[model samples]
Target: MRFFDRTCLSSLLGASLVAGSLAATPVLARQPDGPVDLTAQAQPAKPAPTKPAPATPAPKPSTPAPSAAAPSPLAVPSTSATPVVEEPDTLPVAHWTLADAQSLLATIRGIGAEGLFARDYEPANLAAAIKVGEGDALDQLASRLFVWLAEDLRDGRTPMTARVQWFAVDPDQDNHPNAQLLAQATETHDIKGVLAGLSPKHPDYALLKDMLSKTKDPKQIAMIRANMDRWRWLGQDLGLQYLIINVPEQELRLTVNNQIIRTYRAIVGKPGRTATPQLAEQVRNVVFNPTWTVPQSIVVGEGLGARLIGNPRQAAREGYVATKNADGTITVVQQPGENNALGRVKLDMPNEHAIYIHDTPSRQLFAQPQRALSHGCIRAERATELAMTMAILGADLPPETAVEYNLSGKYTKVPMTKPWAVYITYFTVARDVNGVMRSFADLYGRDPAVIASFAKPRELHTSQRKSNEAVIKLDNPL
Candidate 1:
């Protein structure tokens, strides 16, 4: 068995390993400890109180004059009689000609090439409608089927419920509205071309589709189909330049113009609750020689606060500054130094979860093949190099200036001139750093849910964008 398989088996057999002990007290930092308890049972310390800001006064409402327009309870409202106007971009179903309907039928038959089921679009009903000729019956059914097909292609066949910990909001629905697509298809009479355009713009989507065509094994086909839909879960176009971290593979790809420019080994969150949630955020700034703020879980719960409160010498030696707040609460901040937990740099991407990519003092951890070790945040290997590259590319900082900042050993945050995107994604199967197509162990076991979703009939899209799971803000890089 592989290392990941052995580790996963051991974790399963030992419940304590899979889920940290709830009764165990928090411990102070030495080197990085085992996975931190991030479940709801682990209560975080209450934040210190601050004075409330002054509220703005509400304006008084204007009184309306008494009118003699009171209607009886049985009376129909005048506005209810008005005809509903279709949006300017909405193509009338009655306007769809036989040629256009036939073209859509042809596209529906071959949607399986794009990893979609032809039966899901009600192809037989569409064919019957087409046979009857263009009328209300034909128009309504054709239009409805077209819209459904368009939605599945643009958004995804899988519903939100099956996407475990998915938080990336797809903007394609708004950018290419159903009505607008229908209008364009009918106007140009290029139903196949218009529908094909809805596929994800990412190169991986095309690769997956090509693979699906050549593969014959049932399991491989299902896996390819599941991953193909996974691409649809994200935005159609991941920006021109961005950082995409695949959590399962424990690798980060720096992509430029749909091409992989660089790859870095990464240490992702451990299994269970500390497993990193999927996210798409902007890298606003890169901080060099970053400080680490010790959470109260460590400072107070673990007795680190009491130990360092009066021992300035010990605290200085550890590169930490401990202060007792006015509220009798203890605050601990690790200063910038060689001993700092965040080694030398961190990419500041603001999000609800407080997850970010940063350097680690324990670089040896990256040498391990199965690197599901961090609390939740990502630890990038050779992170200083990654940081300096980001500084030059995203912030337009000169190489010498970046070098100076790194050597200065002071916390310096350089803002990006044009913010680049950072996508924290989970893929069980994808191209590895060496550009070889392979499968990684599902460390978090998220693949089953997606694969199961593919077995059922397609579900309707919902308003929910991200996972409804509570955002656990344990920012401990350890």
Candidate 2:
């Protein structure tokens, strides 16, 4: 009996050891610690969750939140009056005829209802897209299809986005998603199309969906659409693996395999300034104990700008100090540590704007419903693992050692063993989800330019995009 017990114990111990070993591997996913994943990432101090917001009181209609400007109600086009062109005779298609394609947009424009760009013409475009059999025309149709589906939720006539104004109108149903669009998406197998209609559960999903939907140039859309693809293709394209921060919708999705596996809230450069320029770049290295170099603009323009003069020591006390140059232009940088503005780690992605992804000590900001607040660089919630993930996705370096290197205060490149494809893109729409359309703030007002860029009576084409032709890789590669 003792011998039997010993053998059983040994078998259990062996099984436990195997499980532990598997958990240690990066391939295995551990439960997210409700914050950053330190076991597989870095030594990130978890931000405590804030108190639940007070139940939204019955809101006043004319009054917008004093913190920001209130946007007007979205104008949903009246499609109830219009009739769907019954094409019951036609089979679901992979392409659209040029006539069908032209008619999609042409008829809408001819109707003089510009507001119907996303909804009124979408079905037509989808039908037209299916009619196109070959070349870039098909690709253009796909892009348009992506854009329309994505935008309707965010920027188009479809109510894909959450409207704060709705609270004043329909308090009960405002928070409860009106599954008006979602029901339609459920009928399709197009994951991208459905995702394009994502709701408040993921607001940026709608914006990116729309951004993809409005593309006239297939080449551009195809590059950015990989993030929305139903397939996973990573490491096949070895190019500059830079950081991408899309500011308009406040969410940050880190991409590898041309897919977004990591996403979080980012506090971009305040819309009040051109400080955090909308752009993309390669992260040269990370600085653990980073020093914040205050820009001349902040010192010269802010109300407390001259505070560094009489009480320079006060600045240092708050983990900030002024770096005086011979030219008399002083730069204020925050010190690294608990008090540091950039919490612990900063992913250094190079671009025209000295903007990079960084951890913020102000975890309270994450709780805010509309988190479009930031000085310049992106203040990423759950940034520690994101930075660590960036290093691991492209480079083989252990996250611990990377943090140590940053703590050393020495700037160094987290080498990329495999290329990380980071695409910094903006679109008002997408089609990744259940047919719900999503929309967002036209942060740069790039919509008009985007609309103008649509192909001018261009022929429908579908040349296979070389960038998208890469072989799909498996998470557990065989």
Candidate 3:
């Protein structure tokens, strides 16, 4: 029975081999020499390959799709980190024509209402030029009109032709600015606006103009007129910050952008030969515990040399250092101390005249109403306060540094970070702290000349006006 079962199994295996060989024949024919294991499971037979159904033509649209490979039309460039540079301020331009000449003439005549000399603008000349109509005459007149407007707008008047002898620190009166003003006036047809823009912005000037327009008192009018002309002496713009000492008022005002920051009582030069000359200078440095090198005139005229000669020991005790020269001339110097003539501080403003602003040992002098007692240099009442204020405003000397040097009580000079511009001026009439116009004593007798200038016939040309200065040889010291 086992032999019969073995024979049947062999016959069944033979039949299975024949079927597997037939199934793998197509695959083996396509890939000859490929591995074919009989033990591996046979994969299901694939159907006969048929041609893919023809792809339906994509429905044609009105607008064709954009090509993905091409650059986009709305692309923006990457932003840069660099800052953009800005252009400088452009000057205003003028836009006046021949038709605007009459308006300009009317505006010119109204300058008198601004406390300015109207005739100086040559209104009659402008009128005549306008009457002549077209050509070079009208062109010249138009040119002159714009130029005058620009000049008056920037600097009240021509100081040189006005016969103002005092040094005018008017850096704003440069030709470039005048040219710009001319351009502006020619570009703008607003005659009244232009005229209004030209006047001094100071409250005092406006106040004087108001008083002159209404007041009838001759003396009062004359005083106001003289003061008006005095405004012409200074630059149109004083500065963002400056020190102005009114000699007649005996007051020193620290002004920033025309507004008074602080007012200080001051002791100015006496009248006549010792009068403080009106000047514009820069405060270069502040010296603490300053020494006084006595002027020759003071040493000899005050009999200080004689005292030193008679009692050298006494002179030494009083801080005087006397040196008798080979020529028998005496040089005197006071050492830095509390009793020094310059007191505890001195502001150095180097000028040809050797002028300075300093402190004084005599604080009582400030209490007096008329405080004109110095030789030439201004004596500030609260000098230490002034020094501290300057140190703060300029930031040249730190508070600690100022305090250290001030308390040290030693002769030391501290240069200003930014030199403060100082104007030692003499104005008999000016506005007070309350904005009320006040008249001061004409300590230097200088009002007559300034006042006389108003009465003098207006010269045809500014150059024709003579210098009012009278050169006099005097025995008195400067």
Candidate closest to the true structure, highest lDDT = 1
Global lDDT of model 3: 0.60
After TM-score superposition, what is the CA distance of residue 287 in candidate 2 from its true location, in Å? Answer: 2.1
What is candidate 1's CA lDDT for residue 159?
Answer: 71
Q: Return whichever of 1 and 2 wins on lDDT.
A: 1
Query: Per-residue lDDT for 1-478 in model 2, tens only?
Result: 0111333423422432223331211222322212221122212232221121222221121221111112213222332332222212211223334444443434333321121222233334344444545455453443344333333323222121111111111111222222433333333434334433232223333343454445434333432232232111111122323344555556675543233444566676544443244332456664555555554556677833467655777876766666667887666666666656666677766543355677776788787756656655677776655665566445666544655554554444565565543434443333222222334455555343223212111111111112222122111100
Q: TM-scores, in order shown?
A: 0.80, 0.44, 0.70
For candidate 3, the per-residue lDDT at 296 reads 76
- For candidate 1, the per-residue lDDT at 422 reads 94
What is the per-residue lDDT of model 3 for residues 1-478, given as tens digits with 9 covering 90 to 100? 0111333323422332223221111111111111222112212332121222222222112211111111212222323232232222322334346667787777766666655444555566666666767565555545554555555555544333333335544454553364565655556756566556755666667766666766555565666667776675566556667889988888887776666655778888776666676677888888888888787777898888878966878988999888898999898888887788888888888776667888888888888877878776788867876776576456455555666777776899877888588888766677654444567777777666555545542222122222345432221112
Best TM-score goes to which candidate?
1
Work out how many backbone clashes candidate 2 has: 62
Off by over 4 Å in 1: 1-94
Q: Listing every candidate in turn, what is its Cα RMSD in Å to the true structure after a full C-alpha superposition?
A: 17.8, 19.3, 40.8
Point out where model 2 deviates above 4 Å. Answer: 1-246, 270-278, 300-315, 402-418, 431-437, 453-478
All candidates in order of lDDT, best leading: 1, 3, 2
Q: For each candidate, what is the lDDT?
A: 0.74, 0.40, 0.60
